[model samples]
Target chain A: MSNLVFLPILIPLLAGAVTLALWRSSRWQKRVSVISTLVYLIASVMLAQTVSEQGHIVLQVGGWQAPFGISLVADFLATIMIVVTAVVAFCAVLYSLVSTPGTHIKFGYFPLLHLLLAGVSGAFLTGDLFNLFVWFEVMLLASFGLLTLGGERAQMEGAIKYVTINLFSSALFLSAIGLLYGSVGTLNMADLAVKLQDVEQQGLVNAIALMFMVSFSIKAGAFPFFFWLPASYHTPIIAVSAVFAGLLTKVGVYALYRMFSLVFTGDIEFTHEILLWVGVLTMLSGVLGAASQFEIRRILSFHIISQIGYMILALAIFTPAAIAGGVFYLFHHIIVKTNLFLIAGLTQMLQGTYELKQMGSLYRQRPWLAALFLIPAMSLAGLPPLSGFFAKFLVIEAGITSQQWIATGVALFVGLLTLYSMIKIWAEAFWKAQPEASGKDISLPLLGVIPVALMAAMTLIIGLYAEPFIQLSQATGEQLLTPATYIQAVLGGQP
Target chain B: MSALMAVAIGILFAASLYMMLRRSIVKLVMGLILLSNAANLVIFTSAGLTSGAPPLLDKVTKEAPVGVADPLAQALILTAIVIAFGVLAFSVVLIHRAHEVVQTDDLDQMKDTDQ
Candidate 1:
């Protein structure tokens, strides 16, 4: 049973290898990629079920003892993340079948996508800090390949900024790990959680914690370190960007939540207070940036940053309900954001541009696409009876309950701003009359709409029936807030 | 010895950040390489440098080691180095490609993507 923890990572890795072997046959590659992702999704669901039933699954590689060998622990939070990752990966691959150009498919796009899935799963499941770094690299390298695969002029430009900033962040992450190992003498997160509490030099531990904070802040696209995201995200193909928008920054948020909740609880007032301001600033800056953008993808890109602010805010609040809100927000945001990007791709497929000025009358031409878009667009704005509404309700409710008036106020204000921008996209792209200079119309590909429709339905389902999802998130929150079970699971009841 | 190595690492980091802030993408890649190397050195030094002794077990006793260098840090550095090398190599090629297409090494000229 413990061995099942490896399946999520192993399946995608094997799939990547198999897809690479079948590279010459694009048709076979697509079939294999889709089938593999389906299998991976099922495995993830099984893992999530097992975790919810049997508690955390801890696997020490090669049968080594916990502290010495690398460990992979799948608690509720991790399994949930893995499950969502597989869902997004499956949708992205399915969408990519008709959407990704032949040139891209021929150039190992499917394999790279699978590799990314492997990296994301590994990042979610790994129980060691250094091991997390390794997974991050795997993810980064694969993303770099995916980002610049076409070597288009814009892609090259965007990839340059993305690559440089991410590499710098990785350097920061590596040095922090070094300092952490130097201080704690263990890279395993559970052991670090145990030993970090015992270290005499609390100041050094705090400093290292700050270092990790800065590193992950950069990765998470928090304010002052998020310029790279908007600059690069719009340059990739929609499928690639959808997967990225769905999974990548969320991974950073997950790390912050995991580390702060489990390991860095010594100086909550200092560290989390800083996170509070960062989250607020991230929200304001990102929404304001989106408000100023006329391009659809750029606006969406900036909104990603703003949405991240909400998740970080939830983490900063540091209560059970707050963390649950963050988890719920993460779950809701990934689905809605990915669906929006895919819908943007569909609009592009119809209108041949991501520029709002050039796109118009989408509703008149394709009412179904507009309707599909509304599900996610409204949910993203926290409209009632939608998934985002509950997500935001929990987050803001937690904030108010925790006496974080200012942060809560900003979250509410950001929700309004989010709606404003979503409406902006709606007005320009769907509601307005078609411009004279817009390109020729291409019919919506059925293949493209399937994933978007399915994901939108998922958002609707999670919205209308929010009980089970909210309960799961709350349970994850409780588990994260109390790391004793996680530690014991990994360390085999050893103190 | 630790103080000297720390100073060296600090210098590497400073130089890298300086180079990274420049407009030339080539310098940016160079700076990244320097930065990753500095990070590797930090990990190597932080593990408490031990000279000459390798971490190994006795053939019979299987637990004879004492005062040996930390093998974990070395393994970590090796992994970091390889990953960094892969990323840097890709960036170098990306820079070369960007140069060919954009026709400028200056990152300022690459702002068309921002629009």
Candidate 2:
């Protein structure tokens, strides 16, 4: 009831305003942004600890009661998501502090990044469905600005597709909300979870659930809706791409996870089967696309879609262990993906380009960078004892547990192909001789390596000490399967 | 009234999809607007088209609040309208910028982003 729940959103929102006010000086902007992100990280970690120790926290804005008032709820899933978001965001700010292009530094990058974080936090914490829409808008607008910050031709071109597809997704999402409201007459998610059970029109409920599935699938960069991802994600600055790669699609996954688990369990067999097929196709298409790409960022972009498939696959299985795998995969993927993108940027910085064909000699010249890159890359490829291995292990175990042979098969196959893709990068960019004309001998500052090293260490730490993360995800999966803890925490005991 | 509105909404949705399917980016933007408007109207019609009395507290408190229109749908529509407007404004500017930079409003010509 007190204000702790709102702190995650407020810290970044206020920091955004402060950064905008100090826009004339990049020095102050950097200091304020980093400090605010640190504060956000602390607040979010404290929130996670609080949620684990004392159960979910719910705060209603304007002191109005739930089912009427807009509320923020930080259950285990939401709090853990907030914590990962803070970590990724802090890394992004740190990365930007070192490598932001001159043109972008004075041009509202810090402010927009702060605003985007605020929106992401808000989306993760909100209890109302409509409030989620509002947060999506917040994220969309800030991302729009960040995407096109430099106003270069390629940036503009990619921004159009990114903004257009996201806007379309929002429209679809709004339409779904409208229809859901017309059917259920409640915008609060917990309230809908309760009311939907009493609604006799199960077929209509299933239809709307499908609408939600498709909408969130697009945001999550799943199959048939992933074109905008590979198109635009490669165009942004590395810092921007790192944040977008890490957070944006996951927000969509979070939404899908919340709705399907909580509000739309009436027709699971039908809707989840749809998700199941989509997940397999998404995985196949993404890895295949990655296999053919020579551009480094584009390949990673496709892999993002591929990894999304694993997450969706976990959700499709829908068992406690399967969902736990999905949650674990999400946690591991965010860290690994964001770090990979950062290392890609660093590679681009060192070689003066992102084309893998034109890049080489990192192994000979800068073994440490290669070493940093190998940890996350191997983890992403599901190497044993790495974070990706355990993430994949849980999901595949869950897939087998559920007897979904084809999906389970595809999940395993994708892990192999992911290693193949990572090895392709290793061979081209690190193992081969430096190309005659392509080597530029560019240098990146030590600060740029700070975030990358930190992420690499975290990946190692998680991989070696996988028990804690697995247990956390298992608890999260339990809360999701029940949904009463969440519903009760948000709606309280007034009934 | 609800039937007519539903018909109009269907028409709008179909037309917008037709526009969106075209290759021109400008049409795509227009299609997005039409699609969103159609969605708003869908919400409007599905909530019922009764011309009802104001939902004052006294009226709402009564057990039989006669002819009181559903205010929630209207509120949702308004919020959607505002959000859609902001999105559309951004889209329009992006289209113009893309046109200026890419020198074409045709989606096919804008393949510089994809590797």
Candidate 3:
């Protein structure tokens, strides 16, 4: 059981190292990377199952007890995140294998992908704040590598801006950690929760919390700090872009959920208010940007910013149902967003361009492909009977219950704009006429289609049978709202 | 010793911030190195400045007094240094690529790539 807890993090890192050493041999690197990620995916699934059965799995590294050495806790929320990350990462690996095998970035791509997954998974599972910062850097460095792999004119230009901004963010994160350690005297998150409960006048705590929020908000691409995301995200290859678009911002969102729910619960009034306003502003800006977009992938990237607002709004509400809805929303958005990007990538392949202005009559040439694109697009637009609807429904329901008029209205308006933008893509790319088809026809291989199909099916599955996930999310929400569970786990049942 | 180390920390931070504001990428890299070193020094200073008081205990006592250096903080700083090294390596490669692909060392030339 303890071994299962660490396997998800360890396998990917070890495999990543091996991939690097074997980089000159593509066959060995590919084999090692795929096998390692598959092992990680299986471990995450098993860990999720164990959490469902046993409630939570906690392991203290190197036999050091919790609250002393770093500990990894596989709570329902973390396990679910790991499972989702593994699924999306696996799809990315598969997609890259078939689509860009001979591209210049192919040699070192798999290793970095594995390391990124390892970092993300480790960040989710760790119960220590400083460890979280380390994992954040680990993931950020790998992502920088992945982003700049091709060394193209556009990629290098974008990577510089991306790295500079993120390095600044990492500095801020370290400073925040320094402040947190100075004030709290312990870097363990669960211990900090306990300590914070006793600290009078939470001014310092609030200050640190705000610092953490700024660092994460920049990564999550919230309203004021989102300029870096849209500028750099669209410059990379689609496989890298798809995984990043799906996984990276969610890491920031994940940290926000962890910290606010656990260590900084005192100033609900100020924190929740700020989150609500930021969310609404983020929604408005993202939708407006999407409305004015020419490229298909860029439109989707902007939509990601808009959709994040809904999830943050859920946290702002600060209710069990609301947190559950946010969790469910994150789960749905990851799969759907990744699927949409891959489909867009395929469209780029067929038409030799990513601009919607140049892409049309896709449906006429490839009817099934158009239909495949519609499922996630409609899902993104909050069409019923898809997972997106349920996620949006719960968010709206939570807003209504909280009676936050602005958030609820913005959510609805954003949903409509989302539908409008998705429809614009559908009409322009699929229904309208194409000036040139590039070729008479081109058939996509199974590897290309399978990943999209798998992600779309997972989205549909979650929507149709949301009972188990809803139950798990409810449990996670309860644990988050009542963080005594985490504190107890880390402090060894200490009150 | 602690006071002297604290002054050194301040100097490192000031120098790093000055370099961070410079327009050149090489200076930016130098700035990051200095800033990371200063941060590690902060952790060291906070742990205490006694060079003689090793954190490891002799046979006399399993738990050291408050005067002893904190091994925990030292371990953390070491890990942070390694992480900083990784970041530095990545930055070196990325800057090289930027110069190669964009044909410019100045970030001002890179602004046109923005949406």
**Local distance difference test, each candidate:** 0.93, 0.90, 0.85
Q: What value does the lDDT take at residue A465 in candidate 3?
A: 91
Query: What TM-score goes with each of the models?
Result: 0.98, 0.97, 0.95
Select the stronger candidate by DockQ from 1 and 3.
1
Docking class of 3: medium
Alpha-carbon shift of residue A70 in model 2 (angstroms): 1.0
Residue-by-residue lDDT tens digits, candidate 2, A114-228 = 9999999999999999899999999999999999987788888788778777877877787788888888888899999999999999999998898888889999999999999
Candidate 2 — what's its lDDT?
Answer: 0.90
**DockQ (model 2, Cα):** 0.70
Clash pairs, candidate 2, are none
- Expressed as tens digits, the lDDT of each residue in A1-495 for candidate 3 is 766888888988998889889878877777776777788788889888888887768898888886888989888789889999989988888888777646643558888888898899999999998899899998999899888877778888778778877877777777677767766678888888888888886888788889888888888888888877877888888988999999999999999899888888888998878888988999899999999998898899999999988888888899999999999999899999999999999998788898898889999888988988988999999998888999999889989998999889989999999999999999999899986666656778788899999998888888789888788778888878988777777677666
- Highest TM-score scorer: 1
Candidate 1 lDDT by residue in tens digits, A1-495: 888999999999999999999979999999999899999999999998899898799999999988999999999999999988989998999899999999999999999998998999999999999999999999999999999988889899999999988999999999999999988899999999999888988889889999899889998999889999999999989999999999999999999998999999988999999999999999999999999999999999999999999999999999999999999999899999999999999888888889999889988888988999999999999998999999999999999999999999999999999999999999999999988645565777788989999899999999999999999999999999989989999999699
Interface RMSD of each: 0.7, 1.3, 1.7
Candidate 1, residues B1-115, lDDT tens digits: the string is 9999999999999999999999998999999999999999999999998888888887899984889999889999999989998998999999999999999999889898776
